[model samples]
Target: MSLIDELVALHGVFAAGEYSYRGDRFSYKGHVSEEHARMASIMCRATSMGVHMQADIMAGSYPECGVAPAGGWVVRGPQFTVCVMANVFCFLDNQASLNAVMSILRTRLADASSDLI
Candidate 1:
């Protein structure tokens, strides 16, 4: 199965998608609409950029902080959470799903370049 399909098939995952650094939606699966997915891509790209910037700053200042080369990020809310790795995004319902989803994403996208800015 495709990565998107695999993620959506996981329990508690309601949506999954992939995008470019330019915020272009590549593909998506599950419950979100096309419009929302596009918007989500933009948001994810922007947030990832910000995260990398912060990591860079931390690395430069601390040198041994181990914050550089960020792998991914997560935004948690009371009822939902958004997990992002490389250019892939997944919407999950709980913390348990978050761990499973991130593990899969980190392993599957291990070689995905994070230098796209």
Candidate 2:
């Protein structure tokens, strides 16, 4: 199965996807609709860019602060949590699944480019 498929199949993961840095391309599987996936891609790209920008500013202002080279981000909600690594996004129902999903994403997508442009 594909990586997104594999992630969606994992326990507590209801949806998973991959999006381009530009937010123009994406693919997803599981309970999400196509339109939702597209919007998610755009949101993910914007959020990732925002994080990178914050990290850049932090690194420049505080050299000792190791916020540069952002690894990923997470949005925890009452019902679900969205975990993003590289360009991949996973919507998990339980926080318990975060570690496993992040481990897989970090290993498999280690080479993924995070360039903003």
Q: On a 0 to 100 scale, what is the lDDT of residue 1 in model 1?
A: 81
Tell me, by TM-score, which candidate is best: 1
- Candidate 1 residue-wise lDDT, 51-96, digit = tens: 9889988988999997787888999999899999988999888745
Model 2: CA > 4 A from native? none
Q: After superposition on all CA atoms, how large is the RMSD of candidate 1? A: 1.5
Total residue pair clashes for candidate 2: 0
Tell me the whole-model lDDT of each prediction, alpha carbons only.
Answer: 0.86, 0.84
All-Cα superposition RMSD per candidate: 1.5, 1.6
Q: List clash counts for every candidate, in order.
A: 0, 0
Residue 108 in model 1: lDDT: 95
Cα lDDT tens digits, model 2, 1-117, are: 788988988998988998877667898987888999888888888899889889889988998897677778999889889989888898889655788998988888887765765
- The alpha-carbon root-mean-square deviation between model 2 and the true structure, to one decimal in Å, is 1.6
